[model samples]
Every structure is written in structure tokens, then in C-alpha cells.
Target: MKEDYLDIKTPEYVAIQFQIAGLGSRAAAFIIDQALLMLVNILSIVVLYFVMVGMEPLPVFLSHSSFPVAIVIIGLFIINWGYFFFFEFFSGGRTLGKKIVGIRVIQENGHSITLLASFIRNLIRLIDSLPTAYFLGIIMIFFHPKHKRLGDLVAGTIVVHERKAKKKKLTPIEKEINLRGLSQNNLLLDEWTLKSFTSKDWKLVSTYANRFTQLPLKERNQLTKQIADILLPKTGLDSAGKTERELEDMILIIYLILKDEWEFEL
Candidate 1:
């Protein structure tokens, strides 16, 4: 079966692919979020009532004044908005629902979404829910090529699944890397240098190092040079005038360094 993929040539000039999440998964995720929100709202009102007017009958507390009602209204606004914002920005683009559904948001260009982008997308969610229960948003997602809603289009983001799970068995290239005794100790990379690399960098390096050995000579050289062009400069190492083997070795050294910091998850 043919699967739809969201392929982005990142600003870093590396090609990456993610599976595009479709309407069914996205709708389920939203339903989960709304259910959680409702539960929270009810709990909050109950807790506030108990604390503010203990043991008082619910009818009496409500009849006393508008203060409790007003507070509840304000609380609703904060909880609804803050829930999505905090999670999306800090949790790498997954709300609890999205996490459960195994999908996350990212920029159109294949980067982790920025804080501003997160804010914009969620803010526009109000419009996406327009006229009813996401009537407009569902239409946009169904018809659009990328399944993007107005929020996603405006914020330049899309939801996608994580990459295929990494294999447990060591491939031939991995075995060769182990045999060659290539590691961070062989080459120098400082703590600060390592900190500069993001998870995306690790993905690029790992993909290149693992696959280069499997290709034909010409293809291997081309792939090596393309990857080298992107990653080596970050390590204060230049690939210019270096042979393909040397480049491959440098990348392995980087992989060893990055391995200490990153677990291959997505």
C-alpha cells in the first residue's frame, strides 16, 4: 500500500521524511483533549467550592454572590489556553492527547516548532472550531493536501508521527563502527561543541553513518560529501581536501559523541 509522507528538505539542506497523520487520528486526539478538559473543569469547580465555602450546600454557595461564577469563568479561559500552549511549547509539540495518539506538531520546514509558532497555531484554534464542533477545521483538514487546518496553515506547522522504531540488531555498518574502535576519545569534541547539536543533528548524523557503507562507491561518496557538507563545520572540522574514508570516520566520531547525549527515539 502507498502511504502518504510529508517530506521536507530542511533549511540545513538535509532531506527528511515524516508520515502525515490523517483525519481519523487527529479527530481522536482532539476528542481526547476535550474530554480531559471537561473533567478538569468539573474538578476545579468542585475543589474551589469546597475550599471557599466549606460544607455549605451547593445551592447556597451559588446564590451568595457572582464571585465564584466569575472565578470559574476566568479559570476556564486560562486552563483551555494554557493547557495547549504549555504542552506544545515545552513538550516538543505534543499535548497529552497528541502524545497518547502518537503524533506531534512540527514546522513546515521540518524543525521543532518555535514558541511564537506554537502560540499562533493554538490561538487560531478558536477559529478552527468555528460555527460548531470544528466544522470548519474538519473541512480544511479533509480537503487540504497536507491535512492542515487554518491554525496549521497560519502557523506553518503540521502534525506527524515519529520515525520508525530503530532496529534492535546491529547492522553491518554499526558492527564496523564498533570494530574500528571509533569513538569520541579518538577525536576531540568539547562539551560546548556537543551542546550546540540538536536532536535533528543527531538524526542526520546517525542516518548518514549507518547507510553510507551500504551504497555503491560513487553513491557512497556523494552521500558522504552531502552529509559532511552539513555536519563537519559544526565540529570545527572541515571536510575540504579530506578523502571519503576520512569524512566517514569524522562522522562516526561525531556519532559516538552524540550517542552519549541522545537516545534514538523518533
Candidate 2:
């Protein structure tokens, strides 16, 4: 059957499917966010007006002729810019609208949204708003295969339906290892290394393990190397001459060995 899903490789080398949100859903979410932002703008304007009225008797205040207008403009700018930036960056890619709509933003590679990417996407919002009310963005989303707008394309992100659990299928090797039990082999992990990982870290590792096999060979190797580089030092494992496939296998072994701990933390 045909589906509208993005395939993310897990550390177990299996592909997990995440449904891509459609244009209608995205548009509805954007409208909700815009309405909320409008409410904030109105409240801010009223507060500022009251404050200015209270300061009317101040001496020489009128001498700074353009100050009030500039302040109002700057405040609007902050509300417009800060709202999305803070929400997307700090809320793990879900603005209030997105959360309500059961969708979220993520990198093309299925990683969490980064601060820089969020900033870039929001910064290009001006372009998306061209010809009034995100006309250009609407056109782009309608035509794009993934329903991504200009900002998403430029930032290398996509909006997808939020998933509660993305489980990874166990490989034959992993199954064999589990049969032998993790206690039999340390897999180079110890108490210190395990302690270094927080719930978030564990989740990331688990995701990588679950999604590893589904990723392209090059991307799988790259992510494996990147993750290994971060973990090797902590685990005191040497990668002096390990092949890419070997390094990838090492990470999978680590995840398998700590499956119980990860499951508990999750």
C-alpha cells in the first residue's frame, strides 16, 4: 500500500515510518498560531498605550519625536520574531499550534530541530509572507512532494505527525546477543559510561539504534562515526583503525547491551 511517511533508520538497522503532515493540517496550525500572535500584539499595544498616557506629563518626552513610534515598531518586531523562535527552539520544534495540531518540526534526517535551523526557518518567514498571508509559502507547500514551505526547504526540515513510539526491529545479530544476555559481554560499557547518559541521551542513542539500518549506507556510516566519536572517549574505546561498518556495529552493540536501562528510562 502507498503511504505518506518519512523513513528513519534505527540503530537496529530497521526503518521506522513517520507520517508526513499534509498542507491542510499545516495551514490550520499556522492560522492558529497567527491568531494567538495577533492577540499578543493587541495586548502589547494596549499596555504600551496606557504606559505612554501615564508618561504624558514627563518633561521633554515629546522632544524625542519618533521614539514612541520606533518603540511600538520594535515591540511588534520582537513579538513576531521571538514568539516562533523561542517556542520552536525551546519546545523541541512544537509551537503551541503545532502541538495542538499533533504535528512537529524535525530535520530531514529525523533529528531534533536545532537552534540555528529554527532561527533560519523563522528568519525566512518574511519571504514566505510575500504577496500577503504566506501566499508564496502556500504555493510552495502545494507543489512540494513533502508539503514543505520555503522556510522548511531552506532549513532542511519537515513537519510530521507526532509519534508516541518509534520502535526498532531487532536484527538477527541483536537477537543472538540478547539470547546470550548482556551480562556475558560488557560490550565495552561500564557503570561510569552508563551514568554519563541522561534520559534524553539514552533516547537519542536508542533512536539511532532503531533507525540505523534504514538510513543510506553513507549516512549510516556518517552518523555512526559521529556518535562513536562522542561516545568512544567516555567509554574509553579506541577507534584507531576501525572500519565504518565496524564502528556502526559497535554502537549497535552498546545499545543492545543497555536495552533494559534504556527501556526503563524511556
Cα lDDT for residue 94, model 2?
Answer: 92
Which residue ranges in model 2 land beyond 4 Å of their true spot? 1-3, 10-12, 59-62, 166-266
Residues 58-171, model 2: lDDT tens digits: 448654868788988998998888889899989989999999999999998888999989999999988998999789999988888888888999999898999887498978
The TM-score that candidate 1 achieves is: 0.62
Write one digit per residue (lDDT tens) for candidate 1, span 26-98: 9998899989999999999889877777745556646657867787899998899889989988999999999
Off by over 4 Å in 1: 55-64, 168-266
The numbered model that scores best in lDDT is 1
